[model samples]
Target: MQETERLAEVRERIARAARVARRDLADVTLIAVSKTHAAETIVPLIEAGQRVFGENRVQEAEAKWPALAERYEDLQLHLVGQLQSNKAEAAVRLFDAIHSVDRPSLVDALARAIDREGRSPTLFVQVNIGDEPQKGGCAVAALPGLLDQARGAGLTIAGLMCVPPAGVEAAPYFALLAKLARDQGVPLLSMGMSDDFETAVTLGATHVRVGSALFGARA
Candidate 1:
């Protein structure tokens, strides 16, 4: 019941934010990030009207989603974390969308996987917005070529995804990512998390991956 209320509250907040920004609420897709939490906990949110979910790991999602997706009618799962070249086949086979398509190697892997399996998931090229050494996205400058590569390989290049630097105001990063997408003529911007999603929507984020605010703090 508590999860249901939280889901409603989050939806209301997203709707209000979209209204304030003069954007249709239907245009924004809220991805309930279900990383670390079990399927039992996610069922309530699904019952409460959340059809989209994001997971950080292929193994963890594979362990849980096969059964959950079998039971649920319209569930959409997205891989929203770093994806390894080795797991491209599994990720492509299991997920409806992949938000961490970052590097040339992973791109090659996914292309082959898609060809072999006869399936192509919606692909988002993650850009390392902060340019931090440890993060997983391609450099901002490399986006065009990477996008070209994915498209050339016949993959469905959905849009761009990013995670801004921690402990800093994220609006600029989000805005910059949105600009990059527009400059390149890409249609979707997968930005924002639980904290600044409303702000991201105001700046034209089509998809927001929210975790904590929806599922509560992870242990």
Candidate 2:
């Protein structure tokens, strides 16, 4: 299917999911994960009225978004990948929301960066919901402390984000992340991807990051 067709299908899916969950469609924001695709590949989606997009890296986003933003109106970019402490400032300046803040050092770096740049991107504390040792999220037990650190450093905590263990049911992880968000008194939940976004929306995810479902598989 073409990009526009894929986008319509995904939006319909999201709307259906939202209706089934009795949630307003407007409450859910679809973030087109345009990480690997080039500007030419992305323009069609933009023209199709996709205003929100997510990129995985600060450098890649820097290379493309400046020109794209100049031509587009009301475009919102999010950083949906693990962020490095050294790139905090660049990420802040580039992304409207960041989905991978999981450490105190990162919090400090982001705080310093925000102060210097005078721009604050909405932040989400990523939790290692499955407790996978190799994942970049912070441990579940450390959530409260990390949240406190982020807040104390003057970073606005928007909500929580997580990518569940691959090849397993994602509902439970989405539910857990929702609970964590509620317990922390945060409002947004940035869970779900192309494969499990419907489940995530049903479980209270306000943001869903979808890539291949819209862009087709990456080469």
Candidate 3:
């Protein structure tokens, strides 16, 4: 399908899913995960009226988005991958929100970066909901301490984020993340992706990151 048609279809799916959950459509933010796609590729989605986009790396986003943003100034870029402390400043400069804050050290780095750059992007603490060591999020047991450190450092966390184990049912993980977010007093739940976003929305996902479904297969 054409990108425009796909955009409309995805929006409709989101609306339908939200309605079934009795949640307002406006409460859910559809983030087109544009990682690895070039500016020429993303421009069509922008023209299709997609404003919020996700990038997995700070360097790749730096290479592509500035040129695109010159033409599409209203775009909101989100950093949705594991962030390195050394790149904190660059990530702070490039993204409107960062979703992979999983440790106290990162909290310190981001706090300093935000202070130095004078820009406070929305922050989401990623929880390793499955306790997967290869993953970049904190363990569920360690979340409270991490959230406290981030807050004490003056980072107003937007909510919690989680990437469920691949090839497994994601609803349970999404529900766990939502309950933890409520327990922590944060409002946003950045769960869900291209495959299970509808389920995530039904479970209280305020933001869904969709890629191949909207942008086609990545190069």
**Which window of ten consecutive residues has the lowest lDDT sum in model 1?**
1-10
- Residue pairs clashing in model 1 are none
Model 3 alpha-carbon drift over 4 Å, by segment:
none
Q: Which ranges in model 1 have alpha carbons more than 4 Å from their true place?
A: none
Candidate 1 per-residue lDDT, tens place, 1-219, comes to 377887888888889999999998889999999999998999999887789999999999999999998899999999999998999999989999999999889989999999999988888999999999999899999999998898887777878999999999999999999999998889988998988999899999999999998888984
RMSD of 3: 0.7
Higher-lDDT candidate among 2 and 3?
Answer: 2
Which of 2 and 3 is the better model by TM-score?
2
lDDT of 2 by residue, 1-219 (tens): 899999999999999999999999999999999988999999999999999999999999999999999999999999999999999989988999999999999999999999999998989999999999999999999999999998888888998999999999999999999988888899999999999999998999899999999999885
Q: Report the error of model 3 at residue 142, Å.
A: 0.3
Expressed as tens digits, the lDDT of each residue in 1-219 for candidate 3 is: 887788898999999999999999999999999998888888888998899999999999999999888887799999999899999999999999999999888899999999999999999999999998888899999999998888898989998999999999999999999999999999999999989999999999999999989988989
